[model samples]
Target: MAKLTDEEMMKMMESADNAVTGEGPATMAESNDGIAPLTVRKLMIIGCGDGGCNIATAIARKIPDETFVIAYNTSKRNVNEIVCDMKVYVTSDADEKIVDGSGKSRAYSKDAFKLNAYKNLLETVNIGLEKMPDISYIIVCTTTDGGTGSGSSPMVAKLLSDNIDVPVLLMGVYPSMDEDAIAQYNALEWQSEVERIGVPYFVLDNNQHGMEKPKVHAAVNNQGAMIASLLAGREFGNSSISIIDNRNLYMLLVQMGGRLVAAIDDARPSSGQTLDDYVMAMLQKNYQPEPSNVKGIGVFIKGSRELLDKMDTSIPEVQKKYGNAVLRFAHIENSDSVEIAVLLTGCSEAAPRLLEMKNRYDDIVHAQKEAASVIGDVMSGMKNLLGDPRSSKRRGEAKEPDISALDL
Candidate 1:
């Protein structure tokens, strides 16, 4: 049997869509009800500065023809230069609110670029939407802890949701204890905010994910690569085998992305598999990995004994398929169920920016906490100086207190 060429696959996709819509199939060769089969027409990667830029670049590199609109707050820096031919819109006019992702300023800490940044960001999105009417996915990769990525991403998600109806997949990075209070606070707030917006978020922890280098561009490249693969019917970690498993993972991302997209557009979604079912389906799909590609698999088992026992049954098969790919196991004390997250890094060069960011995450977090504390102290002092209720006196009864009148 001859494998389907790119053109054939596309034709099949068109046929599948026709079948699902009851318009008759385009080609009998390609018709499936799976959400992954739904073709992605356009994607806009908002907030591409710091690590977010790398994520955007990865997607840009993967799909040269796909229209990618990058929204960055740093203008003079020209982060767009990193993203090859994709269109870029930098919010140089947005206010100096904490620009998340590496705890950096969205405006390069310049007063000229401060104020109206949020509105500028929204405008960028509007332009992108207008330009790419067929956009099916909007992936916002920002730092949960830093300034621009942290602050702008949620706003973009909200504005986009309010205007267009499409899936918004937010990939946010969380800083470690090293990032300090402000960075941590910003990250937490953004995550909570995006969650409140009811968007499916994929969060990566800087502390947990080990990287080999440290550089903004490098880090994003690594993360961006993961995002591209995960979106294009590829699996992460240990679960990339069995065509069914790959399709299952691909469907999970598409379903999640589609759910948000549908909600944003105010369109009703056809009920499909629950999150639990999706995970289980992926787990059940055999790990018949390509032997040559297999290097090592890291197993993270965190659940009830029953779940562990079930996984125990499947370990041998996984080992047999990947030539001892199992690497490590992490036990979560109170997990209710099992989750097998996979990462396949087939001898590729380690992303340097990622390592730099990971190494500095804790330090940056600490600095942010100190900054927050200092601000809090300053505000408290100002409050005390301006008005102390206990020391207050009636306006007419009190004489004007003069600093010059006091003895030096």
Candidate 2:
């Protein structure tokens, strides 16, 4: 066989550069013009916990039909609730015994997914993915506050990064400050492991937009969907305008790999809200430090076709404000209300909120330890108060029937 010429080589490579296209059996096919436009990278998303499953399923519901979405967890209940393209359940631990859920204990969660259980998850995920030949990227979604997702997601991501020759990104949902200390500390632990692995990631602070469970979950889901659109919405969004096609998303995610990228949506902007207001709010709420370190920004705006024409001017305002950042836009017309999503890449990873959470976690642990010294055990409180008949008490009381055992 004769070797191809430089022209042929260049043409083949220039067809789709870098980590944009998925390398599957159908990754390449012939078309009349030449090679088919495999330039549009395919995205494969896996949601790892209840919060993760909900967000992934919610995104699948809105984006263009046929977008690959999978929800996985140890809980049958969570797996049952998810309605998506695929559902994967870990079932039970390595020994093949069925288990219900992690019950909020990350340690127990990690253990429960051991041996056979772990292999089952890996095999199941691969089996589902094997059918899709053109998988360009893999996104792992999970909640940092819970037991199942929190314990298993980092391990899953790290393992997948090792096993599969694909770039893996993580979307972590951090619990609200008002949540229990278990959740708060769990969130921090998840952060530490994710960072150690060095996969680029972004987080959504629960209760940042609302306090109620449904409201918080909805806000998180919507925000995640907006980011998904940024990466893959070109299929759904009208392509005539500044559409964020596969190449654009490839640039935002893969080419600029290993940076904190956030695409937050602020919907139904009031008539009074300016572009600056929306951008600033999106940045702050998403835990981005400031726009200074942000190397790239992709904006998606949707509105009435007539009104969107006027909003075109708002697109350029981002560069004017951030200076030096690369800017792009994806415009979708015919929405009932105006909504804007701003995607930022290369922002500072040391978000102030993370530090605040760390300090809060430390304070909480310290406070609990301090309280432990003075706070009597609830079960033994009455027994201590009543004094023991067989033993001497700290208060110099005679040993009575130590009602503590009796008290309990």
Candidate 3:
């Protein structure tokens, strides 16, 4: 699981396949370091019902080449409900400008946004299968709420999991309690259901990351931007070395912990140093790498320290394991606890390689067993509450399988 260097990855990307050394390229022919020669394929991007129309519009604008289909429930008043409000602007590289398209490649918010979100998702999948037939991937970017995101997302995940064997990654968002408790609750419910389906989910919550400023509207806008960035190939900070998108490393931070501390020009000796050098320098300046007995790299922090001090605590352990690791830290306004983010870019081959746990066949098996046990317990609880006869009747009436019986 040795992390691939940017040079190595760049070479791959420039070679036969535009791959950067990693498991990120869309096509199998291209190594992670390389990008496969552009192919015209379908990539269905789904957004939840209601305000999610805005997210769908944003996504439609970001990646223009692919055939984008957004499925949502349009029953309720949403940001998109207003006439001309959810206008999706297509970003044109011709003049480096964004302009409205002639509906051909613009945002599409259909009325079916509300008919049983999950059922609608199934219908959308069926439509895509019939229309596109040859799809690269189905990227589900939804904030689990209402019908489209909450209900349809799991169904879509299940469809991909059961029928289409593709690299289906879900970029899900969770709203804060203040935003709407109902939405928050629905998000949690959808999350649990999707987890039961066992797709590779990259989840981010509005509550986890703070905005640039304290203003409410500004924060919401920033959150939207962050989600857009993540969907547009930005990595998540909480991810392991198994998931970092190295290309994005040049410009963006995966999460709040992996902030952009410095972008040096390498004035002194650019020729001699390597990409690893730049990454290491960032870690060294911020923190000292400390080895730990537990094998796992530990980033320790004390109260009342600057960003560098917080980063210092984690670097020693990470560097010892991974040569190119970036560390960052932040202090609470009034608390003693310091938050730390350690980004490992260069894990040695000897370091036990972390496999893609979510999609592994073994993981699925384990998840299924776990889910079964949990469902058994839940059914037993239900039996206790409603009596065995009612519980048995309810079980028979259930349409979906006991998802808890499938959790890993």
Candidate 4:
């Protein structure tokens, strides 16, 4: 046996897709009729800015064929090579020259959206909605540290909230500790604005999972894709207990209305592995704070028949940890490993890093103000105090450190 190459794997997947669609006769278990053939619920994603668009592309690959992932970006260079269901350019016709990027300035992206990109963006979104009217959920993803994502995502989310009846979620990618002050400041500011918009949102911190840039990027995108796959529900298998539909996703992410922390764990079939263990694992893996005023929580566990039969559906361990919160649990069939996903909302106020950023921003402002007040005329004040450079007093004698002992 030999391992398949990327191209080989892709061709196999394409052939399987063709088989499912009647390009050839369908023989797969999933292709068989009768069992409702997986969760039919669909979820749409709109990714804004560089980071968001990249994640969207990754998500598009992971989701089912009918589901669409749309990317919105200002730079042609940013999204040209990216592969997604649709790409909408955020443009400004008024500008004499075409700007390829937001230049790390959120204001630029926001102004462009408000000025010229508004109509096009809204129209394109409506068109997508019309094409996929069955979409139950809409997730708007963006990189909070970048100019375009930080500036444009809030307005985009708000626009969707105002016009569409569907539940919309904003997924903002947070900057890592190693990122520069500008990126940190942009991320911090964007977080504040998104929260104020009153849209239920989640921030995917870039600092965790990996240290290197590419690793961190992949980790965040992969985590987001997993959330999408779980929320949309699988396209095959019957539930041993209750099936988690898009409505559950809505109850936790949208109706809850605050920051979200979602995690998924693989529970291999074993005597020791319990549903409680799976939920606890997810809790441990969550990037956000532990659920404190959790308005709502949705837990979905999928596994084979044997696994589901053996599993204890009770979530006492979770309730004991999170206090009183709306907890919804569902266990469906997956045919593969026992998979579990938990979504917790209403932890926005407990983010410590955002508080640290606010303090840091205030300190910077205060220091600048203090420095400005004192330095009415810096060089002139120094000259007046020292008299003239020609005077002996103006030139102070150097006092060197006695390093003769250290030199030895």
Best by lDDT: 4
lDDT of each: 0.46, 0.64, 0.39, 0.68
Residue by residue across 293-332, what tens digits does model 2's lDDT show? Answer: 5555556676777656555433446556554343232434
What shift in Å separates residue 16 of candidate 4 from its native position after superposition? 37
lDDT tens per residue, model 4, 227-324: 77766765334453355433334545665578777777674745676666677766666654456566455655566767767665545666567654
Best-to-worst TM-score order: 4, 2, 1, 3
Off by over 4 Å in 3: 1-42, 74-76, 79-120, 129-133, 145-148, 177-184, 208-408
Question: How far is 50's C-alpha from truth in model 1 (Å)?
Answer: 2.8
Quick one: ranking by lDDT, best first?
4, 2, 1, 3
Between candidates 2 and 3, the one scoring higher on lDDT is 2
Best by TM-score: 4
Question: Which wins on lDDT, candidate 1 or candidate 4?
Answer: 4
Off by over 4 Å in 4: 1-38, 95-97, 267-274, 287-290, 304-306, 334-336, 359-408
lDDT of 1 by residue, 1-408 (tens): 123456754554453333322244222223365433232345667654465665666667766466465746443354535673333343333453343222354233223223455456666677777877766667777666666567667666666666767666776666654555566556556655765776555554454334433653354446555444444423212211111222322323432221111000111112453322333344333121112222222232334544444443224454454333222121111245344444321211123423444446566667778998997787873545576775778766778678885677
How do the residues 1-408 of candidate 3 rate in per-residue lDDT, one tens digit apiece? 133456754443343122111234342244354743222344566555444454555555544444355644434335333221112222333563432212211122221222233343555566766776655556665555444456555665666656665445565555543443345456556656765765544443443224432343333323443333333332122221122233233212221111112211212324454333444554443211211121112121122334322223333433454443332221112124432233331122111111221124345567679988997787873535555663465534557666896776
Distance from true location, Cα of 180 in model 2, Å: 2.3
